[model samples]
Target: MTKIHTLSCDIETHSSTDLAKSGVYRYCEAEDFEVLLFGYSVDGREAQVVDLANGEQMPRETLDALNDVRVEKWAFNAAFERICLSRFLGLSTGTYLDPASWRCTMVWSEYLGLPLSLMGVGAVLGLEKQKLSEGKDLIRYFCTPCNPTIANGG
Candidate 1:
């Protein structure tokens, strides 16, 4: 089968919730923020997870697709993936993946009167692959910094 020039991406990043409320612009600027996990699909293929913290390199095809202006990128909240990837890719501030090439499922969900979260949307749509239930907890534990307690080994 011929592969389509469409890439779907999701990223887990570290940033202060306080700062992120303003916008992704400020969120990307956070001193400690970094991409920990990256989930992606290319040409509508099966999704794959890249553990960025574990030194996994993105496949060459995916990397090329990311920079290729022709590839259409998508995500539940496309802005977060696009913005975080921009930082991870070392693009300058105010400059990231072109929005024209990206699509946001969140916006589409809202348009259709569906919930904003991936899980909520999936549940409502009865998708077989629902978003993981422990995602929020995992995110809070791994993506956010604790109070720096000795017990937690911070």
Candidate 2:
């Protein structure tokens, strides 16, 4: 069997800018933008979630893998991961990681006439595990911008 060196990753981020309006570049430029969690699986191993929001550091090996061109990086929406990581890694403001090393499953799904949502993809592929419907609420509360108030810390 051929061995594969790949990382499948997803990141949850918080930004004061509206991602739906400003797009990733501008959204990430927000001073308050931060990666809350980074979820990844390496070579099909059990997935891990790094709680960056709580000051957790990513493993050195995983960090290296992200920088290594030889290691493929896969994600449902690879561009977002790549861009967010590029910012996190302190790359120059206008620079981003090379797109050649990344793969986007969202593009593949669209090519295959599947919906652009994880739930839709799960339903279309008849996968046993589906993305939780409740995730939307959590994302709204944490990942998107909210009214800055004393109670929630904004």
Candidate 3:
């Protein structure tokens, strides 16, 4: 019997998805959506980042594992990753990665009465590493429609 491999992934994306307005499915379904960066770790290995924005492709084996239900896939809010990646993989909007193979750290956080953000969980759990403080500013700058003001250099 083959031992199961656990793969954890995190992604940064751009979409018209007003996540607060539309739910995850609709958010992930935005026509302009595209994954920019992909961070991942397999087994017990140190994580690696793939600059999808720079046109890097995931390794064939990693792609195979993502499509393989036998291996476990995990993320902070895994449903978003699963649905978004389905689109990235050209599986169409309604199609999805199997729920049976996906795990959500956010769900687990809610279940444990912990905060449901990477930063929150890290602080609460006293993690040595945490989400970047500048990430939100960066997201606002690039992930949304920006004002064509002089400051923005439109």
Candidate 4:
């Protein structure tokens, strides 16, 4: 087996709450939607987060790493991250990273019939301080369109 250099990444995306209502094709094509936040760890250390919302971009090396076949990318639900990154970077997912090179932690969790959420999985494994406690709220706020009143600051 070939040794793999792993890069763990998590991305926050903005989309509608009603994914079904918009459909996958439309949802993926939604306007003003892009990666809001990116959290990543190389070899499981030196964790870093970049708020793309603040006009931050991943380091060139990180982008290069994604294009390298020798490096494996890990994400909880890699398809979502991969798609989001592709959209954000204006590159097709097929051109960025091979699906085979990405690992989904959620898959492992599902294999064990354990909880698939990051927090739930962390809790099950006794991991201290899972990524974000208020991830749902964050997702709702950033990913979905704000309520009309809230958007209007009412």
Give me the candidate number with maximum TM-score.
Answer: 2
Give the candidate number with the greatest lDDT. 2
lDDT of each: 0.84, 0.91, 0.86, 0.76
Considering lDDT, where higher is better, how would the candidates rank from best to worst?
2, 3, 1, 4
Candidate 1 per-residue lDDT over residues 96-150, each given as its tens digit: 9778888898999999999998999999999998989899899878887667685
Q: What is the lDDT, from 0 to 100, of the residue 37 in candidate 2? A: 96
lDDT of prediction 2: 0.91
Tens-place lDDT digits, model 3, residues 1-154: 3353999999998887787788778877788889888899988589989999999999777788899998899899998899889888989767887889999989999999999888898899999988887998998778775556955785
- Deviation from native of the Cα of residue 78 in model 4, angstroms: 0.8
lDDT-best of 3 and 4: 3
Look at candidate 4 and tell me the lDDT of residue 20. 53
What is candidate 2's lDDT per residue for 1-154, written digit by digit as tens?
3344999999999999999999999999999989999999999999999999999999888988889888899999899999999999888789988899999999999999999998899988999988988998999888887666954775
Error in Å for residue 60 of model 4: 0.4
Clashing pairs in model 1, backbone N/Cα/C closer than 3 A: none
Residue pairs clashing in model 3 are none
Clashes of each: 0, 0, 0, 2
